[model samples]
Target: MRAVTVRPGAKDSVEVGEVPDPVPADGDLLVDALAVGVCGTDKEIARGEYGTAPPGGERLVLGHESLGRVRQAPPGSGFSAGDLVAGVVRRPDPEPCGACARGEFDMCRNGRYTERGIKELDGYGSEAWRVEAEYAVKLEPHLDRVGVLMEPTTVVAKAWEQVERVGARSWFEPQRVLVTGAGPIGLLATLLGIQRGLEVHVLDRVTEGPKPGLVRDLGATYHAKDIEQVISAVCPDIVIEATGANEPVLASLTGTAPYGVVCLTGVSPSGRRATVDAGAVNREIVLQNDAVVGSVNANLRHYRQAADALAEADPAWLERVITRRVPLERAAEAFREQPDDVKVVIEF
Candidate 1:
């Protein structure tokens, strides 16, 4: 089996190498990899930005957004050997205390973030990876091609869930929504907003990025170099900040309409700390009643919903978000050349 192993150093250290293939246990299923999306977190981990693994694990695999077919299924797995599936990456005890009991696996005290082709469990970027059958969501036959996107889409889905949880209804009607950052998460949120019958608007600082055209093509309004201009004009009821940059997050806070909700999904490469204007936010809340919240990883329900949504959405829309597709062997190239790339999936 072949996998992308991270060599010690910076973001450019990832390399492809032959590794032992993962085998399925009694309750596990063996999946032949199809597509694996390279994420910003991958870049961060490679650059030693987030948590680090122990010594030898430096040779760890590096992908989580994946779609594959069940090459083999355990005797009682319930899935057929040929089923096309997209799986949830996080694995947790079905029973947990406090927050975890409410399905917040990402916040579970015993939850391990460094799992699956990451710092913990082996990941799915190899030619074959195995997992418990319960994690895989079977896709419709017609959706095999676009279903590979289920992994990232689920992320946006989870963010949406948080928006709704944090009183999204008090924000605005489904008619107007603003997405800050024309990146992968923002684009997907725009698509979801559109599907929910909202008029979507996307904002970005770069006047000439590779994503504006695609945003327009996806039926969302694109705003370049002028996020403030678009917000004042549109008065969007919902604003989703996906850039993870302090600028975009602050813009979302100031720009949302009174009583509107803002959801933050971006993982800032510069760590979680940001110097926000607390006084302004305090005053704004008193005057306008706006809400600001942060959203993170998905649970079982979000993963299933995202898989279903991707399976049903138009393939043309999916294609627009997927800027590039590289093989597992070129995983480093995908990360190194990420600035201009939208969503680069590592095809196994």
Candidate 2:
């Protein structure tokens, strides 16, 4: 099988080549790769930012957002041939921390979790892949073409789940939501927010692009100016920060309405100086009785929620999210970021 291979921690080594077929264990299900979504993490891995190969392996496959079809499944595995599926990326470490033991590997503590494509495991950027029966999720037949999006959808699903939980800390009836950075995560966050019947506003730098229209089509307001320009006018009740930029993150804390909840979903780079008044921001949170939390990754429950979110979304709108699709032969190009790119996928 031909697979996208990369030498862990080595820059500019991503390439497609033949590899041995996956070895399935007794209870494993073999999935035939159909599509895989490319994102910033794949680019980071290619740039030698951080990636790990499995034990005794030199190259790691380079995709985590995968959609596939079942080629082989153990009888009564709850999946069959031709079923669309996605492989669960993260696995609990051998220690099996309390969270992982409860099937929430996304919340695995002990810093020893292994994730496909990004850390210590081969990924699904290939023609052939396999995962444990319990770790793979089946998709509705209608989602075969768009299911590559399920992984990113799961990210926002988990974030929304956290938002609802955090909002319950006080008297909560959120009506407005502000999402920073209208990228994939931000837009998906916006989608989930609209699904909840909230007044949604998205902030991004581009004045014209697919993003503004995408937001508008979903009946959400889009802003190209800095968040500081309108934070006071709208007084958002829930702020989901997906920019990973320091300024917006700081603003989100102080800009929310009293008792508002803010969820930081972006992983910002370290060492950037944030110009803000720490004491004032603290005072705002304390005085307003607000809650701020961070969310990442997704467990099985979030995956199911993501599927439902996608199902509820207009199919045409979901198709628009996947702005481009490149075949397996042109996989490398899909990893490059483009100005208009909302989501790029590699079709096998």
Regions of model 1 farther than 4 Å from truth: 7-11, 51-58, 93-95, 109-114, 168-172, 207-210, 271-277, 338-340
- In the range 194-233, model 1's lDDT, one tens digit per residue, is 7777799898876665788878887888887566677889
> Alpha carbon lDDT of residue 143, candidate 1?
66
Give lDDT tens digits, candidate 2, residues 1-348.
999988978888889999999989998998999999988889889888889999999999989999999999999899898999998888898989999899988998887999999999899999999899988988888988899998999999999999899887766889999999888899889999999999999999898768899999999999887688878777999999998998889899999999998999999888998677889999999999989998999998998899899888878888888899999998878878788998999999
| Among all candidates shown, the one with the greatest TM-score | 2
Error of 2 at 80 (Å): 1.1
Residue 324 shift from truth in candidate 1, angstroms: 1.5
Clashing pairs in 2: none
Error of 2 at 89 (Å): 1.1
Q: For this target, which candidate reaches the highest lDDT against the unseen true structure?
A: 2
TM-score (all chains, Cα) for each model: 0.90, 0.98
Candidate lDDT scores, in order, read 0.75, 0.90
